[model samples]
Each structure stands twice: as C-alpha cells, then as structure tokens.
Target: MLSYATIGVTDLNKSEAFYTELLAPIGAKTLMKMDRIIFIGKSMKEPMLAICIPFNKEEQHCGNGNMIAIAPGSIEKCDELYNKAIELGATCDGAPGQRIPDLFYGAYFRDFDGNKIAFNHFG
Candidate 1:
C-alpha cells in the first residue's frame, strides 16, 4: 500500500550519509537523487525512503506521532542497526529488545534531523 515515505531534513548531504551507513548492513543503498532529495532502498521496485528539504521553504519539524519502521529481518539486525545508529550520531528513543512477549523485537532512534525510525523484527 506504500510506494515511498518521505521525511524532511535540513541538510540533504548529512542525512544521506547517516541513512546510507546506518542502512548498509541491511543491503539498502542509494537508488536515486534529484534536486533536493535522495531515495534509498534495496532496489527501485521496493519501497523507498526519501529524505529532502521541504518544498515550502520552511523549517523541518518532526511530527509528534510520526515514525518510519523498517523490518530488518532479525533480532540481531535490530540490535546491530540500533547500535550503528547511535554510533552515527542518532539519539536513542529505545534500545533493542523484545517489545512483545514473543512477537516483536525492535529498536528505535531519532535521526540527526529528529525523524523517528525503528529497526524491527516480528515473528
């Protein structure tokens, strides 16, 4: 039901570096780039995440209840990406662990621009 999701960023280049490195462990890479935006994903056919400067020429602010969750495939990945995100300057929203008794494992963080992201695994 989703073609892509976009998050506003103040600096495209900085956001690109943070996302590319943080997502590399899961095989996602830069798929395309336009004037003030960049799309990243495993491939063009898959859902992509776009980071860009807002077209309205206003400041970017993260929405209170907005977040993007990425399924990284395993618990180990959840931890790996969470740690990697921290190493790359993201602030921790939550640490990697079981959120549901035996169903969900996830980690959460806020990017440099304060967009919330989740590295998740659901069984």
Candidate 2:
C-alpha cells in the first residue's frame, strides 16, 4: 500500500540515468532541486526519493536485499530493456525468462553496483 520507495545513492547523475532508464515503463518522475523538493507521484500519492545523496561505496551492492519489481508494459518491453541494460554494461544477474510460465514471467538484472532488480509482465 505504498505509493513509492526511495534509496540513497553515491553518484547522482549515474543513478539518475540508471533509474530513468530502469523506471521508464512505470513512468518514474525525477525531481531534485535545492529550491524545491518535488513530489514524484501524483498529488494524492506519497513521495519516493526526491534527492540523491552520498552513500558509502564500501557497501556490497547499490541496493538492499529487497527486490524492486517493476511492471513492464509488455513482455517485449521487458525483453528490450533487459537486453538494453546488459548491452549498456549492466551485469545480467538473471536472463529474461518466465519463472513459472503462465504465472510469473520476468527478468532480473544487476545495476552499476550489484542489485538484483526484476521486471515482470503477467500475460
């Protein structure tokens, strides 16, 4: 029942690019200016991470154990992004494939650091 989620990152520009590409399908809104902290979600929804702050790089991964599941508009979208991410130098932690066939069809990829992010589309 949450409107969004936020995470601290070390590099603002890089993380912005990564997330902007990653969250394209979900229509993620990016806003970060000292003058104002804009709301990503709609007026009725809660805000996600508004600003990108510095964090320890010594950490194992860019993300916590929790998996951020993004809903792809379609299976092809997932396939395209999954492939694009891999092509863009992201490690393919898991290939795009159906987990349980009809039930769970998705893909997982590792970000700049090491985060197991998944994208799914239930046909």
User: For candidate 2, which ten residues in a row score worst on lDDT?
Assistant: 35-44
Q: Give the Cα-based TM-score of candidate 1 against the true structure.
A: 0.97
- Model 1 Cα lDDT, one tens digit per residue, 3-80: 789999999999999999999988988999998899999998888899999999899999999999999888998898
Candidate 2 C-alpha error for residue 4, in Å: 1.6
- Estimate the overall C-alpha local distance difference test score of candidate 1: 0.93
lDDT of 2 by residue, 8-114 (tens): 44555676676666555556656444422222432335435343353344434454576666666788988887887787667887788988868777888876756
Q: Rate the local accuracy (lDDT) of all candidates.
A: 0.93, 0.63
**lDDT score of residue 110 within candidate 2:** 75
Q: Candidate 1: which stretches are off by over 4 Å?
A: none
Scored by lDDT, model 2 comes in at 0.63
Q: Clashing residue pairs in candidate 2, if any?
A: none
